[model samples]
Target: MKYDPIDSQLFIKNRKNFAKYMQPSSLAIFNSNDIYPTGADSTLPFAQHRDIFYLSGVDQEESVLVIFPDCPKEKHREVLFLKETNEHIAVWEGEKLTKEKAFETSGIKTVYWLKDMEKVLFELMTQCDTVYLNTNEHYRASVETETREARFAKKLKDKYPAHSVAKSNPILQRLRSVKDPIELEIMQQACDITEKAFRRILQFTKPGVWEYNLEAEFMHEFLNNRSKGFAYTPIIASGNNANVLHYIENNQQCKAGDLILIDAGAEYANYSSDMSRTIPVSGKFTDRQKEVYNAVNRVKNEATKMLIPGAYWEQYHVEVGKLMTSELLGLGLLDKADVQNENPDWPAYKKYFMHGTSHHIGLDTHDYGLLHEPMQANQVFTVEPGIYIPDEGFGIRLEDDVVIQESGEPFNLMRNIPIETEEIEEIMN
Candidate 1:
């Protein structure tokens, strides 16, 4: 791993919390993600499943974690099964985690080779009456590929049809939503790396430069700072391209007086930090551009303040819409008539700001958190607001990652990164 080693205490605590919610005789299982294939002999990069990585710190493929908290033997309570490493395998594909290394990575002491999975699970299944199966129940999930976890779950049910199956998504959605102290530390590091990339781009951006050039600049900085790359598909939309929320085709050249909206992030130790910033291609924003930029910045700041404990995601967006509506009114994007006759389902403010204001950010860019549930302290979110004007051939968006606090306002993680018009202009100059 390019990132530094994380303390195993976080995974230990996560397992303890997950175990607390399980039934007395229930056993939970988690599997690492499969290394997806591209061609005959080529495969895409291996990314560990967040659920398995959360429960066990083993970040390798062909790894499995089982939590039988009520096992008859104490050693069998928490077990890890890893791909066995040998001399020839080490020379060819590098060293896979040995039993001793797996123990260091995870707190579990009973570690076995992956080949012994069936034998051990067969014994455990007879002893346990219920099974907690991990599934992708995320609200935004649209999984098409069959994951390793899903395949194992299907086989387990077929073999033991009488075992009561329970979903692990509910427990994980709540647990993973709230950040642990160690997780917060990693996320802060990710944000710090993103800040460096943003600062680098502020100086590198210029008229006549292609949008891909800025993307290269960010990748160079992120690689040097121990980050794999972007947490999600980066959006380097320049000029009218910024009007497209999911614009990622960075093929156009930046022109003077045009604005570039960059929605990019970095991942450190598998933790994500999301950020969005709009800047001028010529190092100076036009009068109208500055007006829209400031309005978006104001909406972002105001929306961040609403991410506090007990705040509902649905109600929070409503409040942020009101804040954006007032800003749009000031910018003359929405008139009195538009506001009075606007549909409640799609407010007038959405004409300028169509995307959501914020979303949970952690292991994944759009991390796990129940939107219907009340917000809790230590949960991290990205507060991003934008004003897209296709007619004017420009758009402006300002975003920052924030952590909900127990008291007072939410803490901004990207506070060190420049956001204000004057500050950005000063740095670009």
Candidate 2:
């Protein structure tokens, strides 16, 4: 991998915590994501499954992890099955992980070749009464294609019909949602890289520049800082395109006096840092543009303070809605009449700020956490608030990743990334 090696103690603790949640005699399984195909004889970039990567630090394809904590033999308690490397394969695809390297990458001492999976699993089945199968139960998932993990689950179930099967998603959903100290440090590193990229763009962006050129600039800085490009597909929306929440065309030219909304973050060591900043195309915001930008910035700051422990996701958004309502009132976007007669389902503030203000941020841009449960400390989230008016010909959004605090307000991870109107203006100048 291009990224530096993460401490294996994190994976060791993760596996231990997951095993604690498992039922006695249950063997948990996790599989790496397949290298997805794009076209004939070509494939898109290989990305590791977040679940498998969390359990074992093995960031390669065609790998598997099994944790039989209650196994009869001690060595079989935690095992890693990797794609074995040979002379010809090494010459063609470079050297894969050696057994000694695997031990270092993951804390598991017992390792085997992928060819021995069936034989070893057959033995494990006889020794265990229950099995924990991994599944994609993420709230935002809409998986249609059968993944390698799903297929392996089917084979395991068919082979051992007598064993009681359980789902590993519930345990992992909670575990991965809460950030470990090490994970948060890595995320902070990613955010620092993203900050550098944004600062670089602040000096580079000007009128008549193509959106893709900005994208290129961000990627150049991200790679230079040991990141694997963006955490997600970047949205470099300019002009009316900013009204589209998921706009990623990046084909338009940044016109003078227009605003460009860049929703981007760098992925460092599989940890993601999400950030969104809307800046003036001509290195200066017009009076009216600054008014709208200031409104969004105010709302973002207020919303981030609400991401404290014990705040529920749904209720937190309601509080943010009230905050946005007050900002819109100050900006003259909503009048007294609009506030009094607004529907509770769709508040008057939503007329200007439509999408959600915040979401969990970590491994994925929209990371995993139990939304129904109350927010907790160490949980990271993106506080992004925007106001889009296509007729107005521009939009403004200010975002920062924050960590919920145990005592007081949440801490901004992107605190160094310039957000204040004056700061941004000064940087552009």
Using TM-score as the measure, which candidate wins? 1
Local distance difference test, each candidate: 0.92, 0.92
lDDT of 1 by residue, 172-206 (tens): 99999999999999999999999999999999999
Instruction: State the displacement of the C-alpha of residue 155, model 2, in Å, after optimal TM-score superposition.
Output: 1.6
Minimal lDDT window, size 10, model 2: 297-306
Model 1 backbone overlap count:
0
Count residue pairs with overlapping backbones in model 2.
0
Cα deviation of 201, candidate 2, in Å: 0.3
Give the TM-score of each candidate.
0.99, 0.98
Stretches of candidate 2 exceeding 4 Å from the true structure = none
Q: RMSDs, each prediction?
A: 0.8, 1.0
* Pairs clashing within candidate 2: none
lDDT of 1 at 11: 93
